[model samples]
Target: MAPVSVVMVGIGGYGAEYVAALDRLPLEKIRLTGAVEPFPTRSCAEPGLSERQIPVFPSLEALFQAGCEADLVVIASPIHHHISQSMLALNHGCDVLCDKPLGASIQEASALIRAREASGHSVRIGYQWSYSEGIRSLKRDIQAGRFGGPIRMKSVCLWPRTLAYYRRNDWAGRLRDVTTGRWILDSPLNNALAHFLHNLFFLLGPAVGLSARPLEVTAEVCRVNSIESFDTVACRARASGDVEVLFYGSHATQDSYGPRFELEFEEAIVAYKTPVGDVKDEISIEADGRRVGIYPSPNAGDHFAKLTEAVRAVTGNEPVECGPEAAAAQTLCMNGVHESISEIPTVSSTLRRRSVQPDRYWIDGLDGDLRRCYERGVLPSEAGVSWAIKGQTIDLVNYDHFPTSENHA
Candidate 1:
């Protein structure tokens, strides 16, 4: 097929990384047409990247007007602008690959999903960890019955953020209301906790539907640098299958231990020790009481690289890795976590099918979910998983590990 023409919507932190990933794809399969950053000065105005000559525009509208037609749009913009930008891209017949969290709110995310469905274009969210060589190797092993069936899973995602971190960006800890214009990021649930929530569903596949409300969650949220948002969060939750999952994310510490993912079974412990960044692409499975290290691919490409492939899939008329079900399930999981904290109980009922459209922005329902969870102790689980419908734990066990590392703040 002709190389899938694509554009990077944002040229900031993740945006820069996305550009790097796009550079790694086969030149024939991918083409870097251009980029759209509202703030050309702010996006790639820096010294080094500017000289690369990848044509940076000041607005999405401007990019479209420049007669630059592309098959896909890769968004690395802030959480605040994800939905709007993605919607516009889809409207223009461009597929989208948004950064994780889908949107700052459920409604916005739902709206973006709706737009994708309406446009009949593919939309893939960025959760590069899922595309990791480590994850792929473990997936191969799991499918091959290497460490038996997945008995349990655990993750210690210590992503530290100092006071300066939030202060650095205006939208860092914001609760935005697109209609009325109100925003705040008062806790770790949305920003930091979001990473883990997305990965949980990523590693486990979308076989399990996520309940809109958190079933059970007990978290100790703390504020370290006087930021309005919680710097540290440690909580445990039970999702659609009554599957107990643990979550801990923080923005208070000076140093972060990075994100660590592990899956345990009766046979052995399969773990992926992920430090922050694009390095370390080895998957190690400790089965039969011994650690067997396997290197799947050294080129654990960044989000842009995988996103390029997704775009190619879109133009080529193939399925997407970050499809609707996966995106919705992930957003649902995030809602569950936030609701669990605020006491909003959610039930996953497949019987209730709603069109994937964002009539309401996500942040709008945060307070409501929290209040409901507190009022109703029993959260409704999505009725699909036989393991969940049967009310049986499915013989899965989980362990939470957060040892004190030298990088602790």
Candidate 2:
């Protein structure tokens, strides 16, 4: 068959990583045909694109207007543009591979589901962990009853960010785009550490296909930074099969723990822990009184590799491993988190604040407090913080019954 043609939207930052991954693939399998980047000469200019001689367009609309056709469209654009861009690509008779946090709001997510059903084109979300070989192996073990069914699952991460990180773009830490008036919940649970949360849901059951859906969620969202969204969050959700899921993440710490996910089964415990900000890690399983480590093969964590697989699946008219249905649980959990809190409460002045650098602030003792929460497998309130507020519970058994309003707006 001819090489599958791909057009990328966005070519800077994370987009550049995609370009490097695509470059490593065999040219006869997939080829880059075009890009949508308004400032190609700026930070977005990538050597891979220049070397491949891919044409650049100012926007997706511009590329479509030029009558350029592609077999697949990969969108690495901002969080707020995902749904619109994915719909545009599907309308043009192209399958889509969009970045995570499928949509900024539940309403937008529902709309994308509707569009995909109407277009009959495959749509995949960029949740790299869901595509990792190590994760897949773990799923197989769970399905084979190696662990004798999961009892509970926990995902914890403590990643710190400087104020400049939020300043990278106008939408970095915003809840709503002032220019487009669209909802953009750029928070820890939704954007930065979303993969960990999504992976927790993916591990419950139905391992080979779409992940288990969320049934309910109770969460507490707090903020110490000046951003519109919360920097610290703790959530407990119930998934299909009566499995309980716990998530605790924060961007307000002085120390970083990277990301760790643990699943406790009736007979064994499966865990994956990595250095801060690293996704490529091995899984350790303790079953039948024996411990074993499973290492991922080369390029197992390469998101571009997963994207290429999705493209191949679409070309072959096969089902993608991480499609729209697999990602719906994430959207429901995120929306439920926001619904749990009417407004984000700020930390009390008792928490010491130190000026790390110009425009950057760090909360003293926050790292230890967060670690305590993880060790105890509880939320901040349950961890004995005087200022912590109890979270609200939400039932998502009837997902469509949840409110679709822009909570932050």
Candidate 3:
């Protein structure tokens, strides 16, 4: 069989990682035929693109207009471009691998689902942690009732970001992109630590191996940093079967803690903790009176390698893991978080902002406060902070009614 022809959209930063991964794969398996990058002058300098001599287009629309053929489209563009780019790829008769969050809002996610279904092409969201071998094993054990049915799950992370991180792009740390009219709610829960939240729902699978659907969501989101969107968030969502899912995430701390999750079942508790600032760390599972490390430490290669395998599965007409439907839960919850924004009152006085560098401020006590919330399995409000406000509950069924005036670009 001929190698799969791939057109990558955006070849900068994370996108370049995809390019490098594709270059490492056997030439006969998959090849980078083309790329869509708005700033080709900057992107062309990337080693992968320059070395491969891959043709670069100004945009996806331009690529399709020129009758460029591709078997798959890998979208590593900004949060605003995900749905539109994915739909464009599918419309052009190519399968899609989109970056995380799937879409900025549930409405956008639903539209992508419609497009993928109409096109009859597979669409996979790039929540790479979902493809981890250890996570897959945990899913299998959950389905097999090894833990005797999940009761509750919690995901927590406290990774700090410098001011430079937000200043890198126009959309970073923004609630909405005024220029594009795109909903870029680049908050901790939705962007940086999103995989941890997605994993919580992924583990509570309603079907044998699919991500669990969120029935309802209640959350408290706040901004400690001088950003439009929330940097710290605590949420409680009820998944299928009345299983409670808790999430605590922050990007305004002095400490950097990688994502970790705990699933409690009737029979036992299952938990996995990765090293700080790395998701690919060796995962040690604790359950049933014993603890054991599973899978070798993951490297940068694991993510794109698995993505390549997913593309192969699509070509062979096999089930592609972590497809759009599996990602809908995260999108739904993300929308819920946005909807609850109005209800979340501002938090002040509790956070002492100390300058870590020239312009970056880290919340001095945020690390300990967040750790308390995770340990006690409570929201910031429940953790007894004076400035914290109680979370507001939102029903997932009302997802379509979410304010779209601020969401559309």
Query: What are the per-residue Cα lDDT tens digits for candidate 2 across 126-225?
Result: 8887777777777777778877878889989888888888888888878889898788888999888888888888777585667788898999877778
lDDT of 3 at 348: 66
lDDT of 1 at 31: 78
Clashing pairs in 2: none
Single out the weakest 10-residue window by summed lDDT for candidate 1. 395-404
Q: Candidate 3 on 355-395: residue-level lDDT in tens?
A: 74655666657778878888888888887765567656888
User: Model 1 over residues 41-153: C-alpha lDDT tens digits?
Assistant: 76543333467666778888898988887888888777667778889999999888877656655556667767888998877776665566655555555556666655455
Error of 3 at 136 (Å): 1.2
* Highest lDDT model number: 2
Pick by TM-score: 1 or 2, better one: 2
Question: Which ten residues in a row are the worst by lDDT in model 2?
Answer: 400-409
Two-way lDDT contest, 2 vs 3, winner: 2
